[model samples]
Target: MAGFDLVVRGGTVITASDRGRYDIGVQDGRIAALGLDLEPGTREIDAESLWVLPGGIDSHVHLDQPQPPGIVQADDFLTGTRAAAAGGNTTVMPFVAQIKGESLRQAVTAYHAKAAGKCYVDVSFHLIISDPTATVLGQELPALVHDGYTSFKVFMTYDDLVLNDRELLEVMEVARREQALMMVHAEGYDSIKFLTERLERSGKTAPYFHAESRPDIVEREATHRAISHGELLDTPLMIVHVSSRAAMEQIRWAQARGLKVYAETCPQYIALTAKDLEGLNMEGARYVCSPPPRDEDSQKAIWEGIEQGVFSTFSSDHAPYFYEGSEGKQNPKARTSFRWVPNGIPGVQTRLPILFSEGVSKGRISPETFVALTSTNHARMYGLYPRKGTIAIGADADLALWDPLREETITQSKMLHGSDYTPYEGMRVKGWPVTTIVRGQVVFADGELKGEPGFGQHLARELSPYAKPGRPS
Candidate 1:
């Protein structure tokens, strides 16, 4: 009989806080040992000269869920998880959107149905509270939080989802009482509305104008305002998809004051520019994400934030939309106005490689920081730490073996996403994952998928790991 279920030998093991050459032993789907040499097992993968890091934990993604009329996401749970596994992610967290008329419980139930028996990687849910009614704020939300849905997002911009300051405070009160983390999409709706109306009046409605409509000031103001709300309630707040330097300064200011304000920035902010949204004609529509990409200066600031430890985590914010068909990015409703265009791009599979190439390989960020931003910090902040984000004895055997010198151009045809386009199409990146292991199972190897749907289990999270005595102080 084999001494262990599997053994990964002779790789440079890297983690957020440690690094060394070690061998790993897996048994019963958990890491059973880590040492200089391990007993042989039934299965052995010789990882000589490879970088063995924890499989990525993408804390932000958007799988099958409700969307506005005339818009449909290109990927559902199964396809999304396949894309995740291809990119070396062993776990993903998407949102469960609570529509205005539905109870939070109903939304969770529907989301569960959509994800059941369909994921190739582990998944979790983050509540999108569009209707925090009295009953929900009073009972359903608290109960749900206690039952393991410990994080939820609130919007401050979209008309259908935006909450007024009073409503924001009410929701914050619920989060505080329930010990849940509140994530904010911080961009002032009125500011965008005002600029949008002005742009329309001037007939400046192209995709490029989309950037003008929501400049850095809008994000800066809202980020500052969100921090104030968090401070007022004495609750920890996370600002998501932070894209501008001005907004980053707001987060830094709050952190300097010893407030529990955390921030996340995405690949688009670092790798893309406003020019991508200025492509001639409708081509620019592909890059129309909210809090749009900024200038090189902002990109520099984003990198600085990462290096300086101002940002706690990084995510793809993988909101995928196909580029063709009536339901895709070029939908008829969006042809005439930038306001009508769906705001997102396909990215989940390319996030790690792009960051590894542009950030780590180029010496912009250290390997340890890469692991911290892409894996460990997300796991810790979202309450999946030891189990999902680390490679140690007793941790889930989720690992990614990397060929650091591998290079390739990112093209849509090579990607596994259901979407027909990638914002990174034609871009070259280095350091591809040669094999991805999830729970001691090889889900992806040498560019081939070897896993099936329903192999993923849902994670029921605990309270924010950052929460502590006088947490906001």
Candidate 2:
């Protein structure tokens, strides 16, 4: 047989369902062989004593997204994908949000332009349907889905983004017919508005009040309602960034009844709390994401959800905004009212490490389960399985070689992202990814970036099998 293009030797391979020591041979960016004593390749690495796993797929990142005047996200495609590669991810799916009056295609086109020649890891897009007009639901959406954009997210909160019940159902109906997955950001808009007005009427306008205004009940009620919509339409739904126990119970309730309800939780839900949003001098603004990190009890519930299989994927939900800049978390209006703070934190680079250290290293979860949450499940959920999310032959050589015993303290200076700060600073983590390979090439190795911008390719995805309208067990 002709010699392999590259080979990774003597590493313990862990996939979502399998684990063993093997030498992986790569040719033309695909796994060509997996066994002991593989033939020599043009290039080889001694991966002894390391845990070799599929590179992470952060399915919920925001890079160079359009924002209102005077507000901007920190990372564009180049820096964001570089950070993703450095952090052991081979694929990232950021959103392509439809502007209020613009066609979805226009948004997709503009987004593609922004990403062209500016990525270091593979990229895909998830559409955000903020304006599901009659024409959109009738023609544009179905066409987009058929063109390989098979999953789209809708919101139930945020003044400019929220879709009313009727509009949401229209979109869900299209999803049902098109066999596309529907992702929802479930939070009651009116309830938050009422609470915010009430709080501001009094003296409770601190950054901490951002948590109080949109309490768990807001998410719970909206989650239940969104699930009900899916149940009515017999469509599968994915609830994104679930934080509160109340919302989780709603998802659990739907799943018990054999509804096709999938859930996703983020790093914030497991690592931070609402109290983190109570910093002095508006410093709390850094942690001011929507469904803002709940209390310790809620944190426990999030972990429980992960252990019990209530969550199908763990994503970064990386919304990058600098804390000290006028366009970021500390924007002029945000200085006075928590309501004005951008609702997200930077985590695309830190997502895998945090989960590995807290869940796998601490024994809260097996490494196999960790792979399932951070890698395999994301691929399956987003229709990239077999191709992007496994260690088997014929899969892409998207790999992260880990030093399972390595320990490092988290700091913004060490991050490759464009953000000015990281919410995970000072966190000590075990088991870092020392090498990240994409498409048979080492993109990041030994703490140095090896991939150049534009090396990554855009992927056109198929419909997720999980999007089908039946319970999965």
Candidate 3:
């Protein structure tokens, strides 16, 4: 009789270390051992001709965000987590948004109610500090940090979301004291507003003009400003959704100086560009995110940034907005006004496959490096290590079996995200996840969800690299 409950064989196990064909034995929901020809198990899986990797951990998804015009997000916890499972992600960290003028604790409490007992895999949250008053900065922030809400994001562009330098400083101080990581949506608010007024005055109100309203310089300036603020306060900062070569250069330059500046890029910047929205189809509104995609040279820079070790983490930043609904981007209320459109695309379900097709299949990045960005590095950076992001002894048995030979065409009809369309429709992907295991239970297998809806758990963080040492907010 085999000594283990499950054994996976005939696959190339890609870990942060060496890569070779190895068999992994699992017992009691932990990776008990890894060797060859020594043991048998109660269950066996043939991973022949496949790439086995740690299931992904996406740290930037919005499950039920409250947006401008009082619009609510289309995806709830159940739907978003299901999509994550199908995409081979066993863990996700979505945002718990703070409404303007509301107490931070209340907002988190409300979001907790939404995520509690309603997941397919393990889940966590990064607080969105939209209402950081003096009371919030002094009282609510530090307690929450100690309570395990270690990382948080702030916006620097939206009229409602933008925080001035003083506000930014106060927030950074909290992070510095709490030892939490601070993430910034870098973009010059005044510059964008000025450009918006100018464009509208000139009758440039079409969807294509949205990119023109906020050019590369605006994002570059904000990226630098955010880094400088972090430097002034001695706090580490991460620039999120970087879309231009110039913006990325600022991060690289700051990091070169030994400043704790980090950056992350999305598929939009790497795969799409302004030309994609040039025809001005009403549907183009769907692609109207901040720091719009840039030209081919910028795309090349993003591609090289990945291969050259620039970014430390990869995330979906997935914010789901429906099509043709009242708040959807497709049916614009203000035909020529770029500000009325939704600002994100549904990407949590496609980020992995896209990376596999472009990075691994093309050999731009080694498979191990891909694992690092998608799983290991995130866990290390965000305080979720060992328990959530690995396939090692004492780690959660969260694994994904990827078939390198299973080719497929991307389409919205087959995806599990709540969006009506797919941004990477028809793109050919050479590999796909054939099975996923979360905490010793099979959640997805052979294109089916085997886990129940409420099998997931809420993760409380103790300390974060992004948080200030001992301060709570």
lDDT (C-alpha, whole model) for all candidates = 0.90, 0.93, 0.83
Expressed as tens digits, the lDDT of each residue in 121-163 for candidate 3 is 8898889888889888998988888898889999998877888
Over 4 Å off, model 3: 331-336, 465-473
Candidate 1 residue 20 C-alpha distance from true site, Å: 1.0
Give lDDT tens digits, candidate 1, residues 4-24: 899999999999988999899
Name every residue pair that clashes in candidate 1. Answer: none
**Cα lDDT for residue 386, candidate 1:** 83
**Cα lDDT tens digits for candidate 2, 139-159:** 899999999999999999998
lDDT ranking, high to low: 2, 1, 3
Off by over 4 Å in 2: 470-473
TM-score, cand. 2: 0.98
Q: Model 3: what TM-score?
A: 0.95
